[model samples]
Every structure is written in structure tokens, then in C-alpha cells.
Target chain A: MSSGLAQPRIRIPRSARAGEAIEIRTLMEHPMESGIRGANHAAVPRNMLSRMVVRMNGETIFAADLRNGTAANPYHVFFVRLQRSAEFEFVWTDEAGRSVRATARVAVS
Target chain B: MTTASRRALLLALVALPAAARADAALEAAMREAVGPAEPEEGGMALRLPALAENGAQVPLTVTVDSPMTAEQHVVSIHLFATRNPTPGVASFHLSPALARAEVQTRIRLAEDQQVVALAVLSDGRVLRATAETRVAVGGCLG
Candidate 1:
């Protein structure tokens, strides 16, 4: 498990047309250790982010429940159809019960 | 039993728990992600190396045949490994503009396992693929 300080960096375009589709990308710094391997064939407990939430204008757009096969430093990309300018919030909670949140603003044109 | 034979037996016994745990986690993750999608044999193509010298940063790519338009598009792609701690790899959401219905990335595999990739279509149909990989020691073995 990573230290409590790590968090995902969320990015959303500053401005988007009211009816245009926008791309959202999220990147997190995590070891994603499987906890099944060690330097000398020992058992390590699995550590990874279990869930992620993406909200647009306070409406949930995307939610994911992650598991062991996830790659280290996991990166996720998703798209949402923008209806109006709003604040997009992305948050993730790992299996260790740590939470990190980020926000991006999109202006409708 | 002789010392060498005893050691071998001990190792095999130890492996049982890890294997069982991996199997359970993989099953649970699959159930949660895509419930009973008629587990296909190899409908999707997984492009990964035969042997990963470094387990920490193995490149993984998955592609499926789909026409990405307003009519029908791939809604998502999920990656999974049987032996990895989380069993569930990363996932991506696609749109028509993505053009190619493919995803590429670097992943960590603790050891060999049946890697499964799943694709959910716009019409709520699920397609899956699997690949077996042999992993070695090198990455995140702290």
C-alpha cells in the first residue's frame, strides 16, 4: 500500500461547448502491488485503489470498482457529453481506505 | 522424508494458498465487472510479450473489432490477470472520436496468470479474450 499522501491528478478542458463531448483523463501514482510476490518468494497483501468516482455538475458520470489486475500507476480515460459549463470532480478510494479528490472546471461556449 | 524432499513438499503446500486466493479474487472481480458474459475462449486479441523480464512495467495492449459511430461503439475495455494482487487491471471508456477501438499501456504482473480482456458494446453486449503470460522477478518486489 502507498503512503496516504498519493492522489490522482484529474484533468478536464477549461471550456467546452454546451452540447459537445469532452474527454476526461485521470492518473494516479500507486505501486498497485499484487501482494502475492516478494523479493524472496514471500506473500504480500494486495494493495490497490478499489474505486473511482467522476461527477459532472454534481451528477455521477462514471464510477469504477477496480481490482488486483490493475496496472501500477493506473491511468483511466473516459468521455462525457457536456451539456453546460460545470465543475467536474474526480475522486478515488483505495482498498486501504484512503481518499483523494481533484476538480476541473469546464466552461460552456 | 529427506531434507530436499521435505523442502519441495513445503514449497508446494505454500503455493496452494496463493493460488486459491488468486482464483477467488479473479472470480469475484469478474462477477462484479461483467456478470456471466458467456466467458468466450478468445474473441479479443491481447498483444503482450511472451515473457516479461521486468514484471513492474510490462506493456499490454488490447484491441477488438468494432465500428465506432453513433450507431454502435465500444463502451469500455477492462484488463485482468489471474495472479495479480488486484486481479483487475485498468479500464478505459471510448467514444467514436477515439477512432481505433484499442487500448495500450504498461502494467505490472506479479506472476503468470490467465489475463482476460473484456469489451462492453453500446448495445450492452460483452465480448472477452484471454492470454497466458509468464512473469519473472524484477518489478515492485519490495
Candidate 2:
């Protein structure tokens, strides 16, 4: 359950038309160890990002509950309708309580 | 018990829990996500490669047909891997703020099996879909 190196990455268009749906993708660095790996479970224990939240200007637009089945370096792609310029925050948290956050801004003209 | 018989029994036991537990876990996940409402098939699209070269990361996309309005929209989506050590893949929660009821992510596949998805609508309806994927190499065992 070591998340010491957790890093969050996000991709979003810097600009978009008002009311247009924009794509947002996020990736976090983690082993996402399922704990079932290796011989007799002697290897890495279960460790994975359990929750992910995407908030736009303080209001959540999307969220995900991840499980051990989620692949390592968890990645997600989704769409959100932007009405104006907003600060988008993405946070990923693991079962160990370690969290990584990243922010991006989208301008709607 | 004879040695050969014991070995066969051990093998059988080893092979049973992964699938059996998966059934129970997946069933509970579905029940919890859908509540008392019975899931109605269709309206959800699950996209996965027919074959995946690497089981560690298989791309999956799920889309549900809905207006995504405040009055009516998809509430959440649940994914399950039929043959993994653990079946629950992930769940995506949606709101009207999202323009579409679609989510894309990557997951692990222990072996060649079917992937299931359930979409719970805001109005208490559950949509279900499944897709099969063949993995060249099994994951979850490092």
C-alpha cells in the first residue's frame, strides 16, 4: 500500500466553445497491486487508487470508484459540458489514504 | 486419501474459489448497485478489444443512451471481470454536469472471459451489457 510516488496527470483542451462537451482524461501512477500476485501471496500486497473525483469550479462533474481490478497507472476518459471558464481539479486516492491532485483550466469562449 | 486423489482434490479446490467467489462478489456488486430493481438489458454499450495482447491493461469503454438531463440521467456504471481474482473493475458516477453517460478506462483480465457492465439510471432503471475479450497473457498473478 505504498503510494509514495503517486503522480496524477490530466489532459483537457485549453479552449472550447460554450456549452460544448469537452473531453477530459486522467492518469495516475501506482502499482494497483491486486495482492493476488506472486507465489502464495508473498509478493506485493493490495494497493490501488480506490477513488477518483473531478470537480469543476467546486462542483463535481464526475467520480469513479476503482477496485483492484483497475489496471496499474489508472486512467480514465470522460466528457463534461463546459459553460464558462472553470478550474478543473482531479484527485486520485488509494486505499492507504495517499492522494494526488492536479488542476487544469478550460476556457469556454 | 491416496496421494493422486489428494492432488486432484487440491487442484479442484484451487480452481474453484476464483470463479465461485467471483460469482458471489459480482452478484453482490450488481445487487448493491441496482437495488431491488431488476436490470433491463440494452441501452448500454461495452467496447473491448476482441483480443488483448497484454492482460495488464485492456482498454474498455462504456456508453449508455440517455438525455443526461437533471430530470433523467445515468446515475452510475459498474464493471466486472468474469474471471479475475476480483470481479469488480470500477464504477463511474455521473451527473447532469456531464454531457454524456460514457466512461473509458483500463482493467486487468486474469484470463479470456466476458466483461460485464451495468448502468443504473436516475429513475431506478438498470441497463446491462457484456463483451468478450481474449487475453494472450493472464494478469493478477504478476
Candidate 3:
């Protein structure tokens, strides 16, 4: 298992119409080694993000299960609609059971 | 058993699954995830560059034509990298509240391979689109 600092980033509009759609972009930094081999020819144990959950005001709007095939510093962008002001929480979990989280707030008009 | 013979046996065991072919494994994974439904041609789109100078961070976008209503919406979206160490890249679950069935992300491509995006709808229909990308340098192994 590889242990390193993970940084999660999210982008959401500061405000939106009550019923309008908004795009949310997210990214996280991790090594995501494939467990194949490194330059020294030693087998590198796989370290990858396994799950991502996005919640809007305590309700899950999107969730994903990632795999080793994902590249390092995985990035995701998706859309969501809200009827009122809410906070969006993003949680990412890796293969080693480590988790990192980030949050963004949007004001619905 | 002789050391040489044991080494040969280990190599043979490793080569067995490696020789099973990559396409077949990918197909099996797709079938397992999305079932046997034949994905329609439209209702989904995959955007990726035709040529990628670096496969480590190939940007990808997938969009499904949906109204984001409770009755008709995309249930899930699955991404696959055909030539990666594993076929299943990621699976996303979405609800009607999303308003739009579009997602974007960065992925790694092992080599010149097809990156497929499959979407399943609430109405029990499947849609798919694929984009072929030629990578000058591999991402996973490099």
C-alpha cells in the first residue's frame, strides 16, 4: 500500500436558478499505481481510488466505483439540479480504505 | 521437480490467462456489468481526442440525451478502457436530480484502444458510444 497526501478539488457555481442545471467538476490526486511494475522492475502494489460519493444536502446525487484502470489524479465532472441552497459533499475512498473529502456550497435562487 | 521445469510451469500458468485474449475479457466484463441488452447507437456520446500525446491524462466526456425527469432518466454510466490493465474504468450512478446525464473525467489509456461509454436508462434501455484514441506513449506501463 502506498500512503500519500490526497487533495480533492470541486467546482460548483456559486448560485443557480432553482430549477436550472449546474455542472460539478471534481478531481483528486493519488498515485494510482497499477501493481504491475516500476522502473526498477519490482512489482508495485496497486493503489487506486475505489469509490466516490457525491451528496447534495444529505441526499446522494451521484456515486461511482472506480478501478485500477483509472489514471493517477482521477478527475470527474457531472451535473446536478437543486431546488434550494445546499451543500455538496464529495467523498473518495481508495483501495487501502483511506478516504478524502471535499465540499462545495451553492445558493439556489 | 527440477528448478528449470518448475519455472517453465509457472511461466505457462501465467501465460494461460494472458493468452485468453483481451477483447474476450473486455466483452465478458461488459456483459457482466450491463447485461445482455444490445446498446443502441444513439442517445449517448463519447468525446475524446483522436490522438493523445500522453495517455496518462486523456480527458474524456460522456453525455446522454435525457430530460432528467423521474420517469425517464439515465440510471448509470459505465466507462471502459479496452486495453488497460483492467477493462472496467469506472461506473457512475445518477438520479433524476442530476438534470443532465453528462460526465467528464480524465483517464489513462494503455495504448491505441477504444474507450467505450455505456449508459443504462430507467426504461431498461442501454446506450453506448465509443471513441478510438491512439496514444503515442502508454500510460499504465510507462
Candidate 4:
């Protein structure tokens, strides 16, 4: 198994002004391999770091389908409109049918 | 044989079986986690550090491009490491109302190996992505 590690360290403000959009920044460690070739001349198996969904106050904010063109350990930043304090959830999936998840909360002032 | 030779022989005999057992256990875990699945191109992204000096605390992230709409969303995500002691890193289940399709965390890379990600949508469509990482020695050697 290639370093069987997870990705992305996200930071979210604990609180935000009401009705104001809050910033959500995420940094994940990834190799983001093109899978053209593997180590030691062995054919690298096909895998993916595809699909991410973000929710704010239980509402979907952003989602995407990624590809080989993406760089390793992808970094993403986005904003969500906040009306009140709510739990933010983030999840990601890979090609080998694996998944990693994390959560953060923000208070709307 | 001298005492030193006898000790060396005994050590080898003991070490051989322990190593073999560990290898077998690891293999079984990999087979159970990784099933027969073709690589589906597109719809996923992996973010990793440009360079990792340590393999034990390598940070990783997986993101899938999907709308968490009532009609559509990501159901689950799977991660695999081909050369690690344990290939299956983690699996995630999403709540329909949660609607968050991205996950992030730190992982232990046994060595420098390619990592793969797969996402299953509520509609049953699967998306995939991959990334190769370099882990320095003395970092993941343990």
C-alpha cells in the first residue's frame, strides 16, 4: 500500500457575523498521481481523489468532480453564507472506494 | 558450532516466522478491503504536500465534485494504500442532509506509495482519483 494516509487540514472560523459569508480554507496532503506509471516500473494501479461536498447549516454549498489534471494534496478555499451557528461537514472519496471525513463548526454573531 | 553461531541461527529461525505471519495478515486485510473495481476517470481530486520529509504524519485530502442535492449526493468514500501494512485507511458514510462531500485528515504511509480514492454517489455512480507520494526514510521506517 502506498503511504495509506488521509488528506487536507481545514480551518474554519469559530464564529462569523450574521448573514455574512464565512471563509472556509482547506489544505490536504496528497500525491495527486497521474497514475501513468508506478514505482519500480510496476504499473501504478488506478485510483482517484474525486468528489467533495461541503455543507453549511445543513445546506449544500459547493461540490465538484476532480481529475488527473489536479495537483497533489489539493488546496481549496470557499465561502458560505451564514445565518446562525451550525455544524459544517466535509467529505471526500477516492477511486479505490475509500473515504475520509471531517467537521468544523462556526457561530454566527 | 560456537555459541555465536548457535545464537545467530536461533534468531533467524524466530524472525522468519514472525515476518511471514505479519506479511500474511497484511495481505488478508488488503484483499478484503480492495475488491475488483475498474478505475473510473474524472470527478475526483487529491491534494497532498509537494514534499514530505516524514511518512508517518503525511497529510492527505480527497475531494469529489458532486452536488449534495436532495436527488443526488455522495453516499460513501473509500481509500486504499497498495504497499502499506494496512491498505484500507478509512471509509466515510454521509448523511443525506449533511450534504458535505469532502473529507480531510492525516495518515500514516508505510512507505512511499500511490494512494487511491473512490466515491460512490447516491445514484450509485462511482468516481475515482489517484496520487503518488514520496515519504522520506527514518520518517516512516518505523
Candidate 5:
């Protein structure tokens, strides 16, 4: 909870047509250790970013439950249809109860 | 027990011997994702590179054929790497706000294996799809 999971990045188009689905991508840096092997050969004890939530304006649009098999540095791409300009909020929470938040705004025409 | 020690116990428990996976494990994972719902093999497409040389970070996509309106939309999408030490990969929950039933991410596979995707629709239908990838090197361990 003290340190790790460096800068997270999110990508979204600056503008989109009303009623059209727009793409959204997010990446968070973490080891996502599976804890499946023994001794030094194994991953260093099951440190994973366990959850992700994406919200439009204030309503949640997408969420994901991550696990050991989700690979190091979680990445996800999803879509949302816009009827008007809105702000998006993304939150990533790890198993140790640490969390990070980011936001982006999209202009809809 | 302290959370740290409990997690350490979990880590100790997962020190496993990766073995050949069985179909039942995949089915169990599917069942765990959605209680008592049998997934039908249609309405979803799982995209994975046919030959993924790097199993650590294989680009993957799962798209379900749904209008994604409030009347009828995907409730969630579950992914499984059947051959990994842990078969359950991830689960994505969707709402009409998403407007489309599609998602993309990266997954880790233990070996040449079949990956499955299950789409749980708002109308109580579970649609499924599977793809096979040949993994040259596993990323589970050094």
C-alpha cells in the first residue's frame, strides 16, 4: 500500500458524433503475480490489481474483476455511446486496498 | 488473522504444480461466474492470436452480438484460460451505458490451451465462445 503501481494511462478520442460508440482504453502498471510456483521461481506473492471501474459522468458504465491470470500491467479497452459531452472517471483498486483514480472528458457533437 | 498473514497463507497455498487442465475445471469456472446457468456455444467471439509466442501478455478480445440497449444487453463477460494454474482470467460487467458488448485486454496462459469467453445477457442467457492459442513460452514462472 505504500508504493508500486506507477503512472496509469487512459486514452480516449477528443470528440465523437452523438449516438456513436467511442473507444476507451486504460492501462495500469502492476506485476499481477499469480503466486503459483514455489521458492524464488514463483511470483512474489499474489500482488494484483483486483478491480477496475469506469464511469461516465457519474454512472458506472464498465467494471472488471481481475485475477492472477490477468497478466502483468492490466490493460482494457471498451466503448461507450455518447449523446452529449461527459466526464469519465476510472478507478483501479488493488488487493491490498490501495486505489488510484483518473478522469477524462469527451466532447460529443 | 492479520490481512498480511492471511495473504501470505494464500500465497503459500498457490505454490502449485501446473498440470494438464480438464474440461470440468473450465465448466466449474463458468459455473462460478454465473450460478447454475449453462452457457450456450454461440453469440460471442473470443479473439486470440492463433500462435501466441509470448503467453505472458497475449492480446485478447471478446465481443458479444448484442444491441446493448437497456432492454437487452450483456450483463457480464467472463474469460478463462483453461490451462493456466488458475483457469479464471477475468470478468467484465457491462451496462447499457457501454452501448456495445465488446471488450479487450491481455491474458496470461500457462501453455497451449483453449481460452473461453462467456457472455451473460440481461435476459438470462449465457453465450459462450472458445479459441485455441499455441503458447511457445509460459509466463507463470521463470
Candidate 6:
């Protein structure tokens, strides 16, 4: 089944103090079909993002395992302490093995 | 092996786990993820609106009292909607790099239910909190 999800959107402040905690927000567009029968009586074939991983300069900072109960267009906001200028990578993977990734750069002053 | 048989095998393997997971209750999943330790009540807090006009996008926040230093930090936070069709809302893994034990997100609450937040610390201590919210409009079915 085609997931029909657009690229994920991630927002991180461009820079932060070396020891400051910063908030990172992300959102992805997805149908999150629950595999339950619809009004037409056809199974929707559950297709939800099963996993999400965030890494900063190759080190995993956050990760999550999602389930079918998650709503469409999963949105998340979390905090991370900035220590150095690095590339932040976000990866989302669905049950079908399809994955979407986004990256942002943060400079620690 | 024939292409069709290989495809069948792959489907079987995938479906097996999915079915097994479906069979496991939400409590079982939480126990499996957090292990047998009983979570304490004070270190974590779960925030949810007392009354939700709509269940589609209810703002939720989870915060834990922790130094978040290298020696002591929260390792993960797991959210659960007690009465939703699926018990597991989301599980978040954290690192010392976060320097704080807090997360904010939007969630869908199927109905009036209690939202639970469970946090695991670096010292293997588990803490939890719960908040009840009344949803007038359904999010899952609607």
C-alpha cells in the first residue's frame, strides 16, 4: 500500500547557547489508516509510522516507536541541549518499510 | 524458491509479529517496554486539558523533575491513552544531551480517558503520572 505521505517538516532554532535547552518541533503528513473497515466496508490496511529516530552528529538523541493509535500527521515537540554545531537528522519509518527523513543544522555559540 | 512463495513467506513473517502485537494488551506492552519495576508517582507530570472540545488534537505535555546531568537523566517517556482503541500513544527515548526531561506534543483522545505518562531514569527508576480529560467530540471514529 502506498503511504502517500509528504516529506516531514522539522523546526529547530538556528543557534543556541552552548548549554541551553532548545525545543525542536516536527510534523509529518500521513493518513494513518487503521486497517479497519470503512463506510464502504473495505479494510483500510493499517499504514502508520512505526518508528522515528532523531540523531545529532551521528549520536541518537531521541527515538520513538509509534502504534496504530497515533493520529494522522504525527506531531512532536521535545527539548535538547545544544553543545556544538551539528547536523540533526530525523527519520520516520512506516510499517511497510517506507521511510522519510529530514535534517536541520544548529550552531551552538 | 519461487518469487510467489518468497513473497508469501515475507508476508507471513510480517503478519505474524503484527498479529502477535495486536493480541498483546496495552498493559502488557507497557510492562514489556518498562520491565517489571513499579513506577513511582512523584517524579513525572502529565498535562492535559480538563475538558477537550475536540479529541482530534489535544495538547499534551509531560515533564519530569530531574537534573538531566550525565550521572542522572531521564532515559525515556512513554505516553498511554488508557481507554483508546490502542493503549500505546507514543514512546520517546531520550539522552543526557537533552538536559531536560520534558516533551510536548498533540495527541488524539478517542473519548474521555486518563492519559498516563511513564518516565524511566538513568538509575533504572521508573516514575509515572496521569491526567484525566473529558473529550466531547471523538477523535478516532470521526
Clashes in model 3: which pairs?
none
| CAPRI tier of model 6 | acceptable
Q: Chain B TM-score, candidate 2?
A: 0.84
Q: Each candidate's root-mean-square deviation in Å?
A: 8.0, 6.5, 7.6, 15.0, 7.9, 10.1
Model 5 residue runs over 4 Å out of place are A1-4, A38-43, B1-25
Instruction: List model 6's recovered fraction of native interface contacts, to 2 decimals.
Output: 0.63
Look at candidate 3 and tell me the lDDT of residue B137: 84
Candidate 2 regions with alpha-carbon error over 4 angstroms = A1-3, A38-43, B1-18
Model 2, TM vs. native? 0.88
Residues B30-58 of candidate 3 have per-residue lDDT tens digits of 88778989788797889999998888888
Candidate 5 is scored at a TM of 0.87
Q: For residues A30-81, what per-residue lDDT tens digits would candidate 3 score against the true structure?
A: 8877776423323766677889999988888899888756778888888787
| Local distance difference test scores for all models | 0.70, 0.85, 0.82, 0.62, 0.85, 0.80
Model 4 misses residue A54 by how many Å? 14
Q: Where is model 4 more than 4 Å wrong at Cα?
A: A1-12, A17-84, A87-106, B1-39, B96-100, B138-141
Which segments of candidate 6 are over 4 A away from where they belong?
Answer: A1-4, A37-43, B1-24
Residue B95 in candidate 4, Cα distance off native in Å: 3.6
- Tens digits of per-residue lDDT, candidate 2, B118-142, equal 9989898888899999999987765
Computed on C-alphas against the true complex, the DockQ of each candidate is 0.23, 0.66, 0.53, 0.05, 0.53, 0.36
- Which of the two candidates, 3 or 6, achieves a greater TM-score against the reference? 3
* Candidate 2 local lDDT, residue B66: 92
User: Best to worst by DockQ, what's the order?
Assistant: 2, 3, 5, 6, 1, 4
Tens digits of lDDT, candidate 6, A40-61 = 3136556778888999999998
lDDT of 4 by residue, A1-109 (tens): 2336575598889987876655677766666553443232224654657766677666665654444334356566554556678898777767665677778988777
- lDDT score, candidate 4, position A17: 86
Q: lDDT tens digits, residues B19-116, model 6?
A: 33433455586787799888888978799999988887788889999988889999888888876766778888988888678887778887898888
Error of 5 at B116 (Å): 0.9
